[model samples]
Target: MARSLSKPARTSLLPWLGLAFVIILCDQLTKIAILRVFSYGESVSLTSFFNLVLVYNLGAAFSFLASAGGWQRWALTALGLGAALVIIYMLQRHGTQRLFCTALAFILGGALGNVIDRLAYGHVIDFLDFHLNAWHFPAFNLADSAITLGAILLIFDELRRVRHGSR
Candidate 1:
């Protein structure tokens, strides 16, 4: 006969939560500074290939559904909040997975930042434009950056898991 083992200890998820909060804080603070300094549609050259611009995104990535009038505002806000809640739950469940948790943290922060923007200004504030020659990428902010990075990290983590034979 074998003795039964007790349950594993519950590890706190505060560190990951703190990282998300810090990302959100930085994203919002930068947006506030840009709002104070730049007028709408303002663009200032930051480098040969970059610019600091003020633009409002009433839609999602690449301005998807941006021309849908006022309805997208509420729709996007609800979507973002929903994503945040889901990411929080994922973080809670997989907090020990460092890369996965970190990615989720970033996504959570970015989603909340956009949600706050939607609530306060009815749109997302974007700056940091990049361009080359006649082509220009969409203007974006720190929150967008975080979300993009998170997505890339998620892909990398998935690849690593496959390589290591972990599901």
Candidate 2:
């Protein structure tokens, strides 16, 4: 049987795409601002809990596989592309579902933001840092925030679906 598009699908997808585009704009603008303002590895403590630390990550979060003599760059680039494709597919298929569409928008924005970084600089730019006395958390940026937010939204969406009998 052929599937038909519905009005609800158009409404949800349009806003999802708009949100993703807005996210991309914000992520890129912040990265550019940080690049122009901060020297690499420079840190400006904003509070006892946070700082803006400029750093480039040649690998994934926490610098995973960063020391693999550079092979991981290509590997990770490929992985990101694959994930982007999967996400786009999900957006196309489930864009009528409000929560699902929101999750996909976040993922799409984040994936594209990092992809732009890898292509332009061969690494991802990270600036946000949270720390305490001698302890530190990994620095990240808008793109990372979106990806994490997307994952959380996905979980919330699932829970909501279950509760609402939409499962």
Candidate 3:
């Protein structure tokens, strides 16, 4: 007979899911504040390199496929939802691996956050902007930030794993 996960093993995934939920909450709340305070294309200079701007992305990171004439909305939404499911599965299997699960949780939260935007408004709302003189980075939101951070953490985790000869 095959053994199943014990109760403690199954419950180990909860903390990571809770972290993802908190990230989603924070991402959505900030997006709400930005929507209430800024009109489309409106920008407020907050520092030498940062500004609060209002923009909607109909595409993925850096507005890729944003001009695909609307198919991207549902496509990205489906993709995000798919990724979230995989992340949850991975979290359940590897919940005891701190760094790996943390990376997955962040990515899961950000992916769902953006997925919510796509489902609710047909686009992802982006407002955080950074620039240098004449060049500006693409505007993004808390969800995007979380995804980026998660990617970095994943890289670090892999490097550490490789260095330490642990799988």
Candidate 4:
């Protein structure tokens, strides 16, 4: 019997894992650079609305539950690990879906990046800042940016899928 040629090859896991590693490297490297160059809470203006600053956030985005004493640390850490595991499961199941895969990769990279910080520093290092006269957004880092962008992409992808009736 002739061998069938229609079967596709299996997808490799290297690229996705590499993407996550790159995200973590960039996140940690930038944080280190900021920590070395600036004092905690010090800002060096790079533009009219942007600054390279150093901050250690002991809480989640916008400092949610920041004042809840020490328990927030373990709680957030567990949440991060749980989310990472879920993303990994989804990636394994649906990685061939490009949009979904990208979204998951970004989220995974970001979650691990911050998780590294929590384990090493007991806090997350945030440097990028945006502000206007009399108004300021909370400082954040590369991982946070990636995570937010990933979430937005996931939403957009879902919306597109819904519009196209592709599920």
lDDT of 2 by residue, 1-167 (tens): 98876533434356777888889899999999999999999999999999998999988989998777888778888888898788777777777777888888898898888888888898999999999987999999998999999999999989988898975
Scored by lDDT, model 1 comes in at: 0.91
lDDT of candidate 4 over 35-114, digit per residue (tens):
88899878888889988889899999998887888788888899999998998877776767778778778888999999
- Per-candidate Cα RMSD to the true structure, in Å, reads 2.5, 3.1, 2.9, 4.4
Q: Cα lDDT of all candidates, in order?
A: 0.91, 0.86, 0.95, 0.86
TM-score of each: 0.93, 0.89, 0.94, 0.91
TM-score of 1: 0.93
Off by over 4 Å in 3: 1-11
**Displacement of the residue 74 alpha carbon in candidate 2, Å:** 1.8
RMSD of model 2 against the true structure = 3.1
Candidate number of the best TM-score: 3
Runs in model 1 deviating more than 4 A are 1-10
Give Cα distance to truth, residue 118, candidate 4, Å. Answer: 0.7
- State candidate 3's TM-score: 0.94
